[model samples]
Target: MSTPSATPATPAARQSLTMVCATMAGAIPMMTLVLWFVLAVDGIGEFPESWPLLVVLAAAVGAYSICELVGFRTPPLQYSNRPTAEVQADSWRRFTASTFTRFAVCEAVFLISVTLAFVADSFWVVLLGAVIALPLFFWEAWPGERNQRRFAAALESGGIPSYLTGRAQD
Candidate 1:
């Protein structure tokens, strides 16, 4: 097993990660706003009452909570005796997959709430959902420098081949 290092992610990797974060940060809010606008223009026609809305809201919250808990606690990336670059690439792919899963959960919450609003013809329901989901989105999807560093640390600790680390193979 390779020893952990304090080394940060490579520049290109860092930039790509930053771009992913930025894109997610922008896209989620825009999606919520678009949904809100659509709801407003289309108007709430008719559907069930508060009970259905509450249920959906609860489910959304539950899903978000589960995703957050799972995503952060578990490192999806696996360690192997491969070239450093190849290992890094595999780790990045796993990280992206995990991140996207969290993103989807957030998106689902907003979309479900918006759909509920459309069905129930209640702007308040949509508003409530968006308000609830927005924070979750920011919390889970907003990748910052800290996150990048943590990911790098995790990768280091996960054990790369000694050859990659310029150490003699055991």
Candidate 2:
């Protein structure tokens, strides 16, 4: 018994969701690129260009996100009050779990980019990857709910409609 007004998502919301998914899809590589570049610089031995590790990294990230979207599950990051409005403990658990997961994943992705870039010998990929990951880490790493504000801005602006310009409603 949900009213239209009570619906969790609207058409505008759906558009936002789609943009988010796409952006998440794109973000992975950017985060890892810098590390890959650093690895490539030292000739340490990750050996990626021949192996095209960047391509594979892209695929892995894309796959992870596609799975999340298709399964309709919450991200291991982000806090929500759905578990228990009544208990203080459960709320804390959810909060810890969300942050822990995001931190681990962000670190892992950055490390993986470095590892792959070292092995692949692709400095460009590594550098770009690290660059992207660093900001995303910060974006997710705020002390409190600060990221939400940025997330809202990203969703709203990235999907700016072509028809919403040059006129006002009567």
Candidate 3:
């Protein structure tokens, strides 16, 4: 027994959401650049401690794989029997929540990389981490119109009506 909100998501809300995601996604590359600059100017001289950086790199690879699984796929809940409005609201809620989670995880990847680069006095860590992360940041984390369409279609196929998918009206 769920009561759907009478007011659906407004276009303004959709635009705001997209902008927020895009802004955060855009920041990642800039942060990577900053790391590169720091390493270029006053890099810590190389140390023989390679084991710790290797361990962190391995963890980063694992984290990237997990992030991919968690970021893009929505939980397949049975909402076909529910009212379209209720289903739409639920879908919207899930989509928005997951978008933020994906963004956070992606940011974590960059953070881990940048932090390791500083600790290890190596620029390569940031580069490798950015390589693993930037694709997903642009592809999955950014809530562009294309992503919205895909998400809406996925939900529609799962039993939510196309109209009730809460996409921003053109």
Residues 1-170 of candidate 3 have per-residue lDDT tens digits of: 99988865555546777788778777877887877778755563344266645755676566667656655566454645777556656766777887788777766777787788877777777776777677766766667666666666555665535442354333
Q: What is the descending TM-score order?
A: 1, 3, 2
Can you give the TM-score per candidate against the true fold?
A: 0.65, 0.40, 0.63
Q: What shift in Å separates residue 7 of candidate 2 from its native position after superposition?
A: 28
- Candidate 2 off by > 4 Å: 1-53, 56-86, 140-143, 146-170
Using TM-score as the measure, which candidate wins?
1
The TM-score, computed over Cα atoms with residue i paired to residue i, of candidate 2 is 0.40
- TM-score pick, better of 2 and 3: 3
Please provide, for model 2 over 130-164, each residue's C-alpha lDDT reduced to its tens digit, 9 standing for 90 to 100. Answer: 55555555555322334333323322343321111
Candidate closer to the true structure by lDDT (higher is better), 1 or 2: 1
Number of colliding residue pairs in each model: 1, 30, 0
- Model 1 scores a TM of 0.65
Candidate 1 lDDT over 11-120, as tens digits, reads 46446765876786576567666765766555643445777578667867686777646655444346555676676566556556656777778767777876777677
